[model samples]
Target: MATPQPRRWIPYPPLISVCASLWWLSAAAASVHEFPTDGTVIELDDASFERAISAFDLILVDFYAPWCGHCKRLAPELDKAAQVLAQLNDPITIAKINADKYTKHAAKYEIDGYPTMKLFMHGVPMEYTGPRNAELLVRFLKKFVAPDISFLESDSAVQNFIDMAGANFPVFIGFGLNESVILELAHEYKKKAWFSVAKDFSEEIMVAYDFDKVPALVSLHPKYNEQSVFYGPFEGEFLEDFIRQNQLPLTVPINSETLKLVKDDERKIVLTIVEDELDENSLKLVRILRSAATANRDLIFGYVGVKQWGEFVDAFDISKRSKLPKLLVWDGKEEYHIVVGSEYLDDNDQGSQISRFLEEYREGKTIKREMDGPSLIGFINSLISIRTVYLIVFIVAVLMVIQNFSQTEENPQFRGIQDGAEGTDASTSHIESCRDYQPVNKED
Candidate 1:
């Protein structure tokens, strides 16, 4: 038998190619459109900037000069960040305005820099002081975007979801609820934690967790065998507090699955390096670290045991000559610091040293260092991966389909099809309900 050959690529006709390119270019334009636009970044000009700002609850606008090298460098990162945000169906919009070309508009926004960034919340603009990278940008934008929440309706589905995510993510399950508020919550903290709503109460899991009331919140971390149950009053503010309290464990094993949780929302990681199972002293430090972490939700607490995570220990540059247990803080950027001596952790009163360590860190006393590679670049690379080819193919296929069904004199009978497409586009702009949501029975 002969080996199969790859399919040959064919070019579109000149007319159709030009039409598709123009259509896509218009769709990619920054100006607000009646129809939903595809792609990562929206290119805004003076005409579209104001409407685009007011249209979204939160919008991140990049004011960039065409000739500036810095602006050119940031463009790709901004594009990648927009792609990530678009995937989540997040309300946050990433848009760019050509400051050099639109001097009047740039002056209006007071963009004095080549690549200045401003975040608009409810149409009010504020300067963005965060890092200029994809991960940080994504993390920063998500802060403004509403949380993405998941709703699970049945007993088996709820249990299975909990069991599945329990090992990786800390599962926050709200029981005996069918309100839109929970869905709203899922979007609010969607970046920080995983949330689920179980409309029908599960008798077995409820008894297992020992919850007495309806509309209660339960957090279960199957990895550590820890469960926290909250009796409601599940109001928005109250539930937000409940979620922050139980979103993460005090000390979790740092692995591929949990690495994301440890690094989510651009928080600094306070990792305690141990042998395998934590000993008495390590456990005491974990308790103190948990207390510190509870107060400082900005920090993620985790542990890397040597026996299980030998590579992790070496990744931190810890040698065999070093002590068995150690503590370190990594900001995922490039700043990494270690607790000077094991005695520093064990010498002081129960929590005093760690407190001072955090204080010193805030005081800018911690020694800055670098990792083998930056995670942000790794993430940006992932975002700008081979998906671009697929995206172009998809766009081309869509354009060809539309062109094939064009309403020429030969296809006069299909005139309604073109009109219906236009009507759908007009109506789609207004239909803002949760399209991802499904009926409870649909899950089963």
Candidate 2:
């Protein structure tokens, strides 16, 4: 009888099973991510790169070469930004991999240039085209982590939101409007601009933003001190178009980054080429361009300085010998148009000159010309300049001349024939050189 009772075994307690399940969940969560949280820049190799990408919700990876000057400059800035970001409740990791050493990974990411910053969000890679400075970089990266559309319930909340948004991105505040109105656009353009809804705000807020009505969407370009208000009809493409156009400032400084932004835009660029963008005169001219841009939102007004980006300026057939402050309307591609009468701005009255230039551009009184050299290949951080192309051609011509001279020395009859056909052959070679290097006038 005792042996039969012993055969009936007892079950484990229910609490034990509950405890076991909790333990398993905790272990799984820890195993999901073992990333460093000490604000240090994670140096990733091919082995750990995939693990890091999967571990962090948001991470910025800099694909860089050790020998690259730009990469060197970016390192300290990244280090500082990493420290600041680490203090956040939801931190973003800054990482770098030597693209030069990791050939396989570099090729995989199509890392054609050094210091290529890519932000990986939930295993999806997006090119990081934000500012490089530590402070601005932090503000820029914060955009990614921010809510699709922040809801402001108070005036101070609205002001604080604006202050924290920084001047790097355009801020769109929907005053007295429903979240559903801007929810879609907020998600669509989250990366390019900041979107928000002010649930409770007074006329002070309205007047400050220069809007007199409720249900008004205000787009603020803080960096440019510009604000534009949109009153409804915000259902379809009108809302989207307004957001798209206002993403850029009234006048954009034409640089590698800004150029990339304008490339896909349908509007032609009213480009002002100056000697030095940082100069007093150039800055004054930019103000005038901004005013014109405000009035003519259909066209994009941009300026480039020869001192800053000589190659890009040269692409427009501009040189130091040419007049400064040259104005043209570019198709944002291979061709640009110059008003025949207003090719250059007057030093005495730049504002009037710019107005006339815009008028001429609108009236189709302009000459279209192709960009010099190749079709803007690799315009971002271009290694080969127009001058470099010209030098290579010049070298080739010199080598050809040397070869011909050597051939003539060996063959006396060939030299005699060459001399006899001098005018015809010389003219042909000269014309060919001009054709190769000169800007093609499409208007011709």
Best-fitting candidate, scored by lDDT = 2
Candidate 2 Cα outliers beyond 4 Å, as residue runs: 1-33, 348-352, 374-444
Model 2 RMSD to the real structure? 10.7
Please give the lDDT score for candidate 1: 0.69
How well does model 2 score by local distance difference test? 0.86
Which ten contiguous residues of candidate 1 have the minimum total lDDT?
378-387
Which residue window of length 10 is worst by lDDT in model 2?
378-387
Model 1 steric clash pairs: 30-43, 146-187, 147-186, 147-187, 147-188, 148-186, 148-187, 149-186
> What's the lDDT for residue 294 in model 2?
79
Model 1 residue 271 distance off true place after TM-score fit, in angstroms: 1.5
TM per candidate comes to 0.41, 0.79
Give the alpha carbon lDDT tens digit for every residue of 224-276 in model 2: 88889999787898888889889899889988778778887888888888999
Best by the TM-score measure: 2
